[model samples]
Target chain A: MATNQQRDTNLSPDEARALRFDVEEFNTEYARILDAQDIDAWPDFFTTDGFYRITGRENYDAGLTIGLVWCDGRPMMQDRAAAVKTTMVHAPRYLRHYNSNVRVTGVDGDGTIHSESNYLVVETLMEEETRIFQAGLYIDQFVREDGGMLLKSRDCIYDSLLIPNDMVYPV
Target chain B: MPDTPFIDDGSNLPLSELRWPDDDLTRIPDWIYTSDEVFQRERERIFFGESWCFVALEAEIPDPGSFKRSYVGDVPVIVSRDQDGEVHVFENRCAHRGVEFCRDLRGKAENFTCPYHQWMYDLSGKLMAVPFRRGDRGEGGMPKDFKLEDHNPKKLNVTIRHGVVFASFSETVESLEDYLGPDNLEQFDVVFKGRKLKILGFYKNRLQGNWKLYHENLKDPYHATLLHVYLATFRLMVAGQKSAMICDESGRHSTMASAKDDDIEITEETASQMKSAFREGMELSDPEFLNYVQEFDSPWTVTMQIIWPNLIVQRELNTLGIRHIVPRGPNALDMYWTMFGYDDDTPEMDKHRLKQANLMGPSGYLGVDDNEAIKFLQDGFKHSQDGEGIVKLEPEKEGSTQTLISEASVRALYRHYREVMDI
Candidate 1:
């Protein structure tokens, strides 16, 4: 469990380290599901009211509202999942999401943990060389529900300005 | 003079080698995509020709001193607004050393100073200052004959229509209204109807195919019903629907317009053919984004306008955007997408626009398919040389058509292309 500022004041260094480890575990599991291409299970890692968006660092820094992919809630995420799985026509490819530098940045009064990590997604298209698809920071807010951590919001802000071709899968 | 008669033509092949396959618009040679010579000629005769290329939106550089980095063909340019509230388009290259000095994509800059030598340029692209004009105490400096006016960066003739900005390299280029023609200009005003625009955001991508293919993709509306299942299944745009591929008199510009029918439903067979686990249903769990609000006075719900050489005005349902095609070479292009909405739009309408935007851009549901198809086309041309693509659908018709099954617009584009390239 994460701790708020009031609770964090009394938390020992070892306890703080454990909280970070927990967040890392959650991120690792989330990455595992995404890299596995399990689109159906992808939204399960998020709460029902989760806000997910993938935007360029330029737009994020400039306070632009649009995103490459924007989902206001889990229903929208499911819709995206269904669309990508069924109707979208794209080349067959494999993606691997590498999440690192996971750190619990802060805790809200209601025990909502804020964490961020660097992510790099490498994709290998059919008969094409593997390339770095996206490199960005995952600014996330997590909340625990029913003894499990789920994303309340995930903002994938990519520093790689120009996307090569099209991004078939979400970051 | 005869000793140095052989000169660099920017490509290995001479101009004579590049010629149209025949005096027809149906057959397109593959060399147009792969040949460097054709690409070079296109840059000179078409991109930098008399066409009015889209540079920036007035909303982007709305205030005085606001500038945005853009491209007119392959040339980097700065689209800036002067203190007097006039827009200017100038080459990004520095006069001293030819460095692309405007590094930032967009910002408020009083004057542009080259980082290489600090040669200063004002908002209107006039050379206003030279750091070492008389040297540091008159030791090392530019020659006394050097004049500030003589070394200004190359500027372009700018024209704005309904807040949409266009720039041209030719001094005597015709008016934008004449360039777009009556038919195309009528459609252009549908989106830019003198209302103020609010910049939503941008989606920039490097397409791994020739720039012209992007134009052809939109102009070739036959593939719209077949290639994109999302559009077909949702009945947003199908072959049976009411649509038209309207072209300008010159055949250079076109508008592929389509109206959506709400009652249309996906057939069970089409749903079963989808290779996914969730084949039982095709309806989206959240169809809020698919709801279209009647805003524009035009009959068409979707209008994709291809304006000559480098601009694509995309109005898919309510999500409006301008796709600026910048040719990197013959093989690839950098597509800069500027998504926007009217400034008077309510918050809900704005969110609806953003929600609907998922159907376009680099990562869009329908957009990914076109990108992949284009890549496949480029690969086909690269791997198998000396082949010509056939665009013979509705061969008798040349310009605008009522049917969606025809490739008349594609043929029209090539007709104009051949005239400009003079091949």
Candidate 2:
């Protein structure tokens, strides 16, 4: 069983390394879900009270603006999925996500893991062909749940100054 | 040649020339909407030469060392906040070899370093460092005559009003207020409302239609009632409301406005389809979404302000935003929509704003319909080059109080387009 000290802010060296590995795995799985267009499964990765945001790197760096997609809880994410799947009509396309350079920054007092990673998404459409849709960094916070680690908050800060195309899906 | 009063000739004019014929009301010349040469000329003479394009809101870069990279026409630009909190707009290209300097979209950095050769620049765009300047070889170093101060990106004339920032490539363009004029300026202030802003998010999309088509769509109130039945179903707007589409002093800017008529009743058939979760009788999830909060003394629930060239201040229901259109080619345009709410919104109000966000964006019910309509319209134009499209609704008066079914705003846009493009 994990000790109270290991669960809280202070972690043994071995536990710290394990927490880093857990965050890296979470980042990879999250990207996989989005890239696969596993729309239903995407929201399950978040905690009940989670924040999911996708903002321009410019806005995040300046620390003065909000995201393009800002959701404070899982219900907002679920609502977004329902709308996109049922009501919205868009050109058919496939997305490929590439995430790398993941690093666990630290673990907070409540066993929440803070991590960051870099990402690039390439989208292919009928006439436009495959192009760089967006390239950015993700600043994330994860909490240990019953089954696995769930994302408490995730902020995707995109570096592509000019969005190559519409941001229809979550990053 | 004598100055051609920018009229329509109603004949086979060169793609470079445009003429407005007195007989034609709805149809415009095909060349104006579908010519590559015309687009190139617009980029040269209009976007890159004169117009003041919106770069970023001042609220986005409130702190020192903050920066964002954007575009003016097709030209890459960087809007930065200096140590003193002064905002500046400069060309994004490096002075050395014309490479783009700031690759990242945004960040707070005391200086920017060019990745190509390690030439560093301060936030003020002044050259700060050169990595190999005093090398061991000394012979392969930069020349002694190469001055750092001379390498700053070209500065542009900029203006800020109600926290929104505007920049002009031409130094002699009219003042921001004069450029917007009274009719459109008032609408801008009403939506922006001089408050410190908390940017909610951004929605960027690319349309295959000409940029003007989007402008025409916004100016045309005709489609809102028909193409988007959702509006009528929700009783947010009705076909019998008193509305007007007015052009600004320059005729380049316009406002399509209509007040809410509470007296108008929603039929049972329409109301059943729009039964919102938050309130049964209320069309929108939030009552504010239906409320015209009246920050200003305007008598309109909806004010769509078309700033000349690209910026649009959209004040619809409770959603307030700025739409910036970047023309990619004759057949394509990229739209960037920045959503904003005031700094003082309560948690519940913020939630309300988020829920109403559904009214816009790629997945938005209204926005998706507009996107589909714009594409179909472009397809129609592409297939039918021989026939003219009609814009002659409400012909009795040149500009009249708009009906829910009128396309007068579209006609006004073309009239203004001819003047600016010297068509």
Candidate 3:
């Protein structure tokens, strides 16, 4: 469902047409990699100085600089991936993320594209009913790297105020 | 399921029927956890009983008209600062028909008008006016003998210590100082200590377990080193560190503190003894978070003070926070975590606090396990009915512990609980 599609927020006709295809491919691949549980490769899709965070909309909307996971660079993200993949002990589960309403919101003076998409993640734990795990806006800042788009920053701003239990997997 | 009309309903039997296994406060019956009756009793005997419950920080409502919604026990209440700079806390329910007046979480407002019938109230919870109180052209309205004074919302006794605010439902609940006892009050003053509080942020979560389990989780001190390997891996709070679990005289309040031991020399024997805690391969690529600046007067790196039923004052190094436990029902409890820092925190000190946040919250290395472990305990009781738990750590049976590895505080919590609930 998240294939190559042209989506624009506030951009010229030519700029929107240029970004829609490559940016869509980058985001689709990003989601596919995480959904496929190849989580170790997550840090590779970002620049060496990339930033990523998972936070509730309450803190984000209020301009509070706090997050459930705040990693300033790729090395930190790699360490997080390592921990979640190996060391953490949590309930057995499966997760599927549905990302829609993708759009390029703005372009910075430095040619970095500010993009956003609505996401819904459904988690199915062992022998339990599948439920909507998290719903949020993935605010992304994309930069071109070696002929392909790489994320400079990604903020998962969830609307759900209260976390149900342990968020075992990174959203 | 249909046959049971009131399943899990805590039947209010005689107080004698709910007897403890013994008088030593060592064993905790499982029924107290799953009992609806015990929960209801707590709401009345403790929440509405003589206990000071932490409501909000005075800094949250710095302005005269600022107000924030909070929970006192299970009842909804509004904490607002009036025009005279006096803090006021009252039940959010309208005296008329019991409809909730304020729905907003926090806002600046001089008046709270119930949307149900358009009844208005001032910041002091005094009924200011009513829509069409007299009449519409003298036809359909209130009777001539209506008294507005009789309809005022229930006002609570508000206490402000340092920057923290507390409210008590009972008009005669002992002074906040006496209620906390001298030792606990001194520890309470340690974090609060008259320094202006700067609001940082908030993180809230709901666990599907009884509320006391969370209290016990904080009090256990035993779970810290064993369950959360991150504390051990980073050498933040190992069991080998100098720690103390101090309980008040009545065991109603307690403070569990752990110091960073700089003197411990690591030998081969010590390393092997600590092998289970420290994983060899796990390393934080960015370990700048481990850097600690001595902020407090005390040498302890981590201190968690349980203010009886509702409040948890926590200081994990420089990252300070308060946890407000709101028991939703017999089976579910919600935790409102307000993360804050002192007003005069240096820029580097602030960043240090934010980075060290990795140790707590939904995704925190140590905190992630504690939240889920509470669920695991609640799940344990599902298999058997009328079963109980044993908390006999520290064979001396003292309520306080000299080491981190003891259930002394857990027993102390129930000891006070039994006295309060009179079970």
Q: Which candidate leads in TM-score?
A: 1
Each model's DockQ score: 0.54, 0.17, 0.51
Q: Evaluated with lDDT, which candidate comes out highest?
A: 1
Q: Give lDDT tens digits, candidate 2, residues B270-387.
A: 4454333112332332234334444556778777777878888877766777888888766668888888888988876666666566667654656776776776666555545444
- In model 1 chain B, where is the ten-residue run with the lowest total lDDT? B1-10
lDDT of 2 by residue, A35-84 (tens): 78888788888999898877666556546345566677887777666545
Best by DockQ: 1
Runs of candidate 3 with Cα error greater than 4 angstroms are: A1-10, B1-16, B262-276
Task: Calculate each model's fnat, 2 decimals.
Answer: 0.81, 0.21, 0.51
* The TM-score obtained for chain B of candidate 1 when compared with the true chain B: 0.93
What DockQ number belongs to candidate 3? 0.51
Docking class of 1: medium
C-alpha RMSD in Å of predicted model 1 compared with the true structure: 4.9
Q: Which of the two candidates, 1 or 2, achieves a greater TM-score against the reference?
A: 1
Candidate 3 per-residue lDDT, tens place, A1-171, comes to 222234445688787767766677787787787678787999998899999888888777668777788777898788778767755656777888788777777787788987778888888868667878788888888998788788899988888778887676676
Q: Tell me how much of the true interface, by contacts, candidate 1 captures.
A: 0.81
Considering TM-score, where higher is better, how would the candidates rank from best to worst? 1, 3, 2
